[model samples]
Target: MIRFYHAPGTRGIRPIWLCEELGIDYGVEMIEFTKEFRASPAWRKISPLGKVPVLVDTADDLLMYESCAMVQYLLDRYGNGQLQPQLGTPEHAIYQQWNWFAESTFARPLGEIVNHGREFPGENLIPAVVAEMQNRGEQCAIAVGEAIADKAFILGDNFSAADINLGYSIMLAERFLSNGLPESIKPYWQRLSSRPAFIRATR
Candidate 1:
């Protein structure tokens, strides 16, 4: 069995959702983000940076971090090709494209929005930063929207691991939609958020 170290309401939601989707018999070890929890020696051994979503592959004695990587790994190892595209194929190219975009373009700006919002709440500068972030987020959302517009999922008919990564990225950005998100981005978020996997992940 794999041991997943996670904190609720954090990025760990990505892998937790993947685990649930794959029907893997994984153990969830909840690690609160409180000062006391952060200082735990055991948790530190798993994640030196004290981040959530650290996956301990007990069989191989491998500890994996990063939500996207964990999701991809789970799909590759346990999904039995159900949620991954064939390598070097067009679908695989698109999978990598959107997955990288979600992590680099979407997740980064969205994180900046959250970080700056918390660091400078109610200040003029925070709003300005949020606006810039929202603009970047909107661009990424548009790209994702166009990709999934006519299809039911990001990979066009299948809910791939890329969807899990990008879907969560969209969800993170949606929390700040009231700040400066363009009207065009709403339906994209609605589509991603309405997925059964997304609903189960949040719960």
Candidate 2:
């Protein structure tokens, strides 16, 4: 069995949604977001950083914590080419590009915004830093928005795991920034968010 350690509204949702879409049976251990949980010795072994998205595949005794890596693992092991392009293809290259773009290029700024805003709110909020992160996050959002705007999914006609990876970041940006998102991006999010798998995974 696969065990997904997750918290509501965390990046762990990405892999959880992928599991649902692929019809893979898995168990979720919902960890509450708190200092106590973050400091737990057992969780520390699973995720040295105490992140919510820790995947332990008891079947193989494999432990993974990175959200993007976990999503790719599930797809590679179970997708059977359903939502991914075959390796060595042009589409597969583009898929790889989007996966990296979603996490490193896009999720970085959004994460900064979330951390700063939450750790320092109201009068303590750093106007300049938040503004910078929001600006960067918005730019990344525009690129994603334009890419997925005319299509039903990220890779045009197919609903690929790239959408799952990118879609979760979009949700995070929307939750934190909540202002001046590219008008084009909002509808793309609506489309992804309404998916039964997305709904079920987050719930």
Clashes of each: 0, 0
Worst 10 residues of 1 by lDDT: 177-186
* Candidate with best lDDT: 2
| Candidate 2 lDDT, 125-171, residue by residue in tens | 98999889888888899898888768878889888999999998898
Among residues 3 or more apart in sequence or in different chains, the pairs in candidate 2 whose N, CA or C atoms overlap within 3 Å are none
Q: Kindly report which residue stretches of model 1 are placed more than 4 angstroms away from their true locations once superposed.
A: 35-43, 121-125, 179-192
Question: What's the residue-level lDDT of 14 in candidate 1?
Answer: 82
TM-score (C-alpha, index-matched) for candidate 1: 0.84
Q: What is the TM-score of each candidate against the true structure?
A: 0.84, 0.93
lDDT of each residue in 66-113, candidate 1, tens digit only = 888888887778788877789889989989888888888888988888
